[model samples]
Target: MKKSVFILLLFVAGSLMAQETRLLRQPTLSGNKVAFTYGADVWVTNLENNITTRLTSTGAVESNPVFSPDGKTIAFTSNRSGTNAVYTVPVEGGTPTRLTWYPAGATVCGWTPDGEQVLFASPRETAPSGFKRLWTVSKNGGPEILLTKQWGNNGSFSPDGKKIAIDRVSRWDVEWRAYRGGQNTPLVILNLADMSEELIPNEKTTDINPVWLGEKVYFLTDRDWTMNIWSYNTATKELKQETKYKGADVKWLAGNKNQLVFEREGFLLTLDIASGKTTQLSISITGDFPWAEVQWTDVSQRASSVSLSATGKRAIMEARGEIFTVPVENGNTRNLTNTSGVADRSPIWSPKGDKVAWFSDAGGKSYSLMIGAQDGLTPPKSISIGE
Candidate 1:
């Protein structure tokens, strides 16, 4: 039978070449472990031996790790003291404990079902910093209580924390895909013993991470256009669709009583609120990506656009999408649109010094111009712009 179909295509290509794919970012789940955030640090995973440890390797970028309802503590978000505050460590890794300094920067958003309070989300007394509120600070820090005066961006804490499901208004673009606009609200649930409010069912589209647990609340929805996993039922008010994921989009959901972790496409998934099954955790991260190693990167403070050389003896720059040229005092430093999968950009430098235009999309559908020829050696003429 064709040698058993070529040995079942080499056992599905050697079981997908012994698996390894990682991008991981903002995951949370607790109860067998799963904190996440790659490259910018913070990692942890066990889910029965998927083993991944590495928690917080400083240099200012840590992000939303959250977990600390007794999961031994995590609470993240750190620009390492240049803002974006709120820190805390020890989920088996030590020394972090900073906790909110406030000069406008807070986001952690989790902790406080009696873990002694951490939760965040800020706008520091909104006046035009663009609405946000729901604070709390005291894991031994000083004062910062504001819990909810409306205006939100992720909240969850109900299992007798006296209610709070929140998500009042947030979405200046949570990734945009299939966004039905108007900031897509619908997910309130408040009620701190009578501030009463129970929305959930907005029809606008991008509902977001709400969480709640026990009689159900969970969230993240694009109402069927990608970001999946949903549920509502606070006693049969029915609204289900627990993950019908059609490939990538349910990101950073987080959960506990029997799993629910999320983040998709860069892998790190979980879900199993009792076998509603959705597993993807095989994790394999092996150290040192040091901003993706290979060193040597000054990028003149992220250039953006420079040009010169109409006899100025070389310049052209353009940073963060590559396209270099440099040499105003000697040589060597070319790069010119190293096309990291085409995005080239507005480079411009040719007025009789031998080409260097830009604008490419490299035909991954439209936008061309391109022109090249200052030593990336011939072969670059393109043209074709629009559509």
Candidate 2:
């Protein structure tokens, strides 16, 4: 009986440790595989078996992973070299090859319909530096060719590669939900042959992340006051709403020929083109998070609200939500409020130089005045300041 109970407890502990990770972003879909950005690295998961593998583990941020046309390679942007640039790695994982060398950073959008080149946006040659234009570089590495003279930040190619659907303006803050300002622009379908432009119907709402699927251009719009999937049929000139997500704005919409994948509230969801059905993809990530570990940090450079003692023997300051004092000519720096989880601010030295005072939220209900010994030898006395 004792052995059985012990085994049951072990099983329960294992189950609790297997909870799925949320907050995944920038999801791209192609066939049965999906790639996204998590923990500042790029990760790929196979939908068939639900096996997730970390592709890039660099210290720099890697984001916006777009699959190749054949789904065997992923193109993403990384700031590993001190500036954002384009890179491509095999879908199964391998050494990434840098493709862009311009000073201005490039953001990976998607692949050309033919899979011969990787599409990206950059303001390299633009005059004002605020306008970004779409450019493409060959997968084998060569000069990047400008797709169009018109300004474009993110775009997708048509099935035949003759035309492209692009968002002309990039918002300064994409997370500003329901933003209906002048920056809000309609998706532009630009004809490569004549440079003619066709604007999708709009009423000053934010429309972005255009993905071309079949004869329709699918995008995310805030026309209904929440960003959701909407589509426009190029053949019939008809518009339709694809998904009615009211909770969190759908972001980073990407697609293949038959399916679409996006992020909503930090979870990845997919929509089938034929059935119009949306399903959340279950993904679990297990690894050691070294950044989340507890470690001592030097707060000297972050010190604020400094005050000198009455006789100038010591100085008190607040840093990293803690109260600290440093000797003027000798002794070590003393941390008065060592509480790491509580916020302590506005520290000052007492007029008599016998004590230190600060306002802290240690009570968890309101800010309170905390008085402690000058040498941190005694616990602090808290007097609540009601909200």
For each of the candidates, the C-alpha root-mean-square deviation to the true structure, in angstroms, is 20.4, 10.3
TM-score for each prediction? 0.31, 0.76
Worst lDDT 10-window in candidate 2: 4-13
lDDT of 2 by residue, 1-387 (tens): 111100000000111135568879999988899999988899999999999999998889999999999999999999999999999999999999999999999999989998999999998888855689999999988999999988898999999999999999888997898887899888999999999999999999999999998999999998999899999999999999999878778877999889999998788999998999999999987765566555566556778898889988778888878777877766677778777568899988778999888999885778999888999988989887765
Assess candidate 2 and give its lDDT. 0.87
Q: Per-model C-alpha lDDT, please?
A: 0.79, 0.87
Task: Quote the positional error of residue 372 for candidate 2 in Å.
Answer: 18
What is the C-alpha lDDT profile of model 1 across 1-387, one tens digit per residue? 111100000000111113565678889988888889877889888778778889878777989888888798888988878888888888889888887887888888898788998888988878856688888898878999998788877798887888888887867657879877677878888888778898987688888888888988899887778888888988888998988878578787889887788888788878888889887888877765555544354555767677777887767767766677777766666776565545677788778878888887775777878787876676778878666
lDDT of 1: 0.79
Off by over 4 Å in 1: 1-24, 29-35, 40-68, 74-89, 95-214, 219-223, 240-248, 255-288, 295-336, 339-359, 362-369, 374-384
